[model samples]
Target: MPVTDITTDAENLTMTLVADVAAPVDRLWRAFTQPAQLERFWGPPGWPATFTRFDFTPGGRAQYAMSSPQGEKSRGTWEFIAIDEGRSFEVLDAFADENGEPMEQFPAMRMLFSFETTENGSRLTNVTYFTSAEGLEQVIAMGAIEGSRLAMGQLDAVVQDLRAYAQGQGTRVELLDDTHVRITRFIDGPRELVWRAHHETELLKKWMLGPDGWTMTVAEPATDVGGTFRYAWEQEGAPETAFGFEGELLQLDAPRREVTTERMSGVEGPGTVNDLQLYEEDGATLLTLLIEYPDKETRDTVLATGMADGMEDSYARLEAEVLSK
Candidate 1:
């Protein structure tokens, strides 16, 4: 019960997820069959989904769009193949285009979800069977396992939250994101402490690294508007590597925010401006960073290369630094 079990058959390319809810079979079935109820927790944590057409009968189709917490949206459709009231349901699932048309690149798969009543409550199991090994492999390669786990975890939380709300608990984090991630966290520390962690050479050594086996050789920051800042890292027993940025400090509000317009070398063709804003909040500080690229292709490439995770990790490190000090 409570998503306490999951099994995957790599050979058969099938995944089975089981969850137990304290609600009765009828109530659970309603949560599954009702479009409004389904939309409340159909997506991974942080994503708010909306269903367009949900006609539960066999041969009917259900179309929906899930909007990520960060604003990216994806569409999908499910054609109901079989439905046994309060027992089981099967569907053909596939991705849909922005205009709600099914996409050719995404293959349709069969999904069966079953609801069984028990003395404790209800057991819900979802079985996904792919059409071909290639299809299964493609889904697996796209991190489906982790995504499913995240979604299921969210579902569990949603169930508990719903139960609590029914018994009179207040609001909760109803929205979630499945893609297009950006990390914006507030740190509970002094502004000077936060600034020192980011600008100090000793702390920079603990974070920014050029490459494997490389070490930071230079980190110099001038505390003025027309000041200069340089950072260079080199590997042991190898030629030195460096990246330089020269710019004018457009604005420096001290202990609060700083803005700089600089021409960065070795990263595109120069004339790149990075805007970094810092503000005091909740007895600490909040930092927002926006790096403007010359073109959309570069931005897309950066996202594909795991920029979200990297930035999140960097912020986590920043948080640790602030706490440690």
Candidate 2:
């Protein structure tokens, strides 16, 4: 059900195609604007496209060519007219020569692209308008309708991958210093909810426990400046191996930044300093955690505890159980 509807009006000299895609407006818009992504889906099933230029702005230009299996190449160009960031845009599309020069005899048309949010996801609309009915008939007779439908159908899977990568389905770990590890990820939730998940006892308990078989029994989060915070979790039916973190709040700013001094549940050495920063991007939260260890050995110990996997699991649970609500 990629291409939901295709309406062709010979009298009005217009053809509109619609697709209900399972992606956010921003993500789908990027796929439509970015050169690397447009190359993946701008052509039909057998013919793959190669984008040579992509300037998604007013008075900009996008040039690409589709190469068929038998070494045949078809070039095209789009002269952008208007753009509304992540919402909509208008362009004049036409056939082009190998050097991206527009061909005079080809059917040149103005096309409007819109990405609108819907109950299920985003609804994408592509409307092509010609100056005269005869011009519309010329393109329609060339199988433009079926070709456009096939081209748009390839967008679903690429959009899904882009969505997942943005939501921390991939790893993003960087080392700032010898004794520090920084992890950044985009959580599929609002900034306020993600901030609350880190400070509220009940909300923290829903996702902070390492894996599925463990539970956080005691979570006392002192969210005020200079307050002491404590948390505890243990494997089910094995209370002897409980573990968590106790820390003191160094700074407090709701839904934005927080700094704390934390010690592992029962480590024999020094504690770590954690600086958590949250930023809102297009209605989602970007979380950055800076963990500082007193020594390189301590940092290595923390990383060896499967820290990345556990953190990813917790964030996944937070998205599904807390934020999605």
Candidate 3:
């Protein structure tokens, strides 16, 4: 999984996404080409996609439907223009009817997908071009940016599972105690990369926030004993709801371990001391997070906030944007 970037350009009538997935180029290419895997993560979180037709050669076509929980379905098609196996492809994209025909009422566009190998994994650069600025605005106004983010977020889990199977181990998370939780994961990088991501403001902003619609408005990191840092965020449309976490560095052992006491604002709770341990494991980094709450009740309360899923998403994004970099 990489940091999924979704942005639109009004002047150029283009939408682009640049992601770094911590998987081999061949694996990602296969996932895109194979109908079965493609359907698993082709749509946003709540919608599951089904491909009725898939042709993988140049000048081929793909037709699929994304069905929502309410039983409503959205159909789409891709008319492949050119293809270079395991490298890149270009296609014409348009809304389609359930019967495999274009929906003339909807807009159509062109998309180009390219893959480049990185030091640790692969990078995908996807650019969608619209025929006119009005067409671009039509899709964007219809929630294209949000939908693209949700769809790409789904890709993180799929690629991570594939990598875990090949690694001989999977990520483990546990409730170690009534007032503590533990998370251990095999990060596909050296310990230094993971450590830098945790300690640097620039790297933290890349993937630290749990999901889309939130931006890191403030980031100040000082990884020294007794030093303090402030990290804050604001929702896309809710400035009044902006919140953050401020903490003091209690212990600092570069690339290995860190200890801190943090107070989270914008949410209810007292300060908690956290300890993180990182080490090399089978050519990868194994990160262990020990969370300590002020009381058992607070720990239970925090757990009920769906923090586990948020943390999982963060770690996956860390791989996509930070570790692979």
Candidate 4:
């Protein structure tokens, strides 16, 4: 729990959050400035954030969305108002619609983020100023304070050394809820190349084969939102051992993030929504896939089939065959 205090001033129409982080001031600053790092902790727990556009300069803007386990998305925007290099910054924050435009029904606020060194590590001061007391009350009623605390509680993981934290860890899966699972793998490659490996048919065909005996037969990838992608695999020397998945692309942000609806080739009804994100730091990329299944039974059935091990095998091949060279 990094947060020390969360206070509200009704008269001033402001809310302040103070936290002590066990990281250097510079490291703390980097976590806030970098979109990848910020995304890791910007949303509370099961509702993870994805930043599609981030411009870290005065007069610039950022657009992001927090997705709930049930596939509900709450969008937000930030307009950079001022900056003091690595020490502090200010922005106008507001709720946004699906198109990234601010929603007039929700209250907008001015936020100031200040960083300073402390004896143990660093201190972060986040103050949000609302236009009116009712505006502040409205946000508070929406669970802003508790949500912010839970969100900041995750900052410690972001500030630590990425390689030290995840390099040796194989494909790891964590059940976020009954229907959502988050899978992560650290790839020893830059973000762009990793993204290319996922999007390019030639590159994907070389390494996406799950196990040694399997081979990719189809690799038609979706090129735009609403477009569908198909992939199939067959066992070597065994044509009958064929399986595939097809999905429609929902969102795309090159070299960073994409969301798709995945389903087995023949099976229909409803399928999982796969949200893939790539974040790079110090020449290494962390790939995260958040999969939303229709029910717990479906999630369990998929995981019970040794999915993590299969993913690990594919990721290892990806590094050895495509990224290493």
Best by lDDT: 4
lDDT of 4 by residue, 217-285 (tens): 999999998899999999999999999999999877687778899999999688998988787889999
TM-score of 3: 0.52
Candidate 2: clashing pairs of residues? none
Q: Which residue runs does candidate 2 get wrong by more than 4 Å?
A: 162-325
What TM-score does each of the candidates earn? 0.51, 0.50, 0.52, 0.76
Q: Give stretches of model 4 more than 4 Å off.
A: 1-20, 33-92, 96-104, 110-120, 125-137, 140-157, 237-240
Better of 2 and 3 by lDDT: 2
lDDT of predicted model 3: 0.77
For model 4, give the RMSD to the true fold.
Answer: 4.4
Per residue, candidate 2 scores C-alpha lDDT tens digits across 1-325 of 4799999887787899999888788888988888867876788643557788888779999999876423468999999999988899999999999789899998689999999998877989999999988888888898888888877876764677534546644446666557767677778778988988988888988888767899998999986787998899899999988877898887665776677889976777689878776756557876767677899888887798888888888888888889988
Candidate 1's error at 266, in angstroms?
Answer: 29
Rank by lDDT, highest first: 4, 2, 3, 1
Q: TM-score of predicted model 2?
A: 0.50
**Tens digit per residue, CA lDDT, model 3, 294-313:** 78888888778877677767
lDDT measured at residue 16 in model 4 versus the true structure, 0 to 100: 98
How close is each model in CA RMSD to the real structure? Answer: 13.6, 16.8, 17.4, 4.4
Write down the lDDT of every candidate, Cα atoms only.
0.64, 0.80, 0.77, 0.91
